[model samples]
Target: MTVELTTLAAIVAMAAATVLTRLSGLLLLRYVNFSPRSRRALDAIPPAVLMAVVAPTALATGPAESAACLVTALAAFRFPMLAAVALGVATVALLRFLGL
Candidate 1:
């Protein structure tokens, strides 16, 4: 089957756009020096965004999820973000398996 010209152009354009966007972020950050406060704020962004997205779904799902979410939030304070997320997922899985 032959690829249409417009489809091939669209695919190339999207790839170019994605590469440019990523390179722009790296280039922009190379010149900027963050203050301690600004740095801390930037560091907090990932977990904050994760919670903002997860919390509502957890609350709506049921007690097992809500409890798991709490455990995950507590873990985040003591562990790295990846560890915290893993613990949260494990907690939810265990709780669900236990029929909670």
Candidate 2:
């Protein structure tokens, strides 16, 4: 497969940027002391970021995906995360199969 020079350069640049971002966060943390409340807030960032990314796509996709998102959210409240995820996957598959 032939890769274009610009595409390759873009991919390499993205990788470098991602590495720099992660390394900068690690290095910055070493010099900073956070309160317990601040630490807890920092810890919550990852899931919030994940949901921020996933929620919009889920809601925008279609009826099946939207329904699956709701099912997953409700499932998450009552079941383990893994179970909730599995149920969401199954729900989407079933809904799609049924032509929703």
| Best model number under TM-score | 1
Worst 10-residue lDDT window, candidate 1: 50-59
Give the TM-scores of the predictions, in the order they appear: 0.78, 0.55
User: What clash pairs does model 2 have?
Assistant: none
Q: What's the lDDT for all of these models?
A: 0.90, 0.83
Estimate, for each residue in 1-100, the C-alpha lDDT of model 2 and write its tens digit.
Answer: 9999999999999999999999999999999999999998886665455456558958689999989888877776667667877898999999999999
**What are the per-residue Cα lDDT tens digits for candidate 1 across 12-66?**
9999999999999999999999999999998888788878878897779898899
Error of 2 at 52 (Å): 2.5
Which runs of model 1 end up more than 4 angstroms from their true locations? 1-12
TM-score of candidate 2 against the unseen true structure: 0.55
Candidate 1 clash pair list: none
Candidate 2 at 2: error in angstroms? 6.8
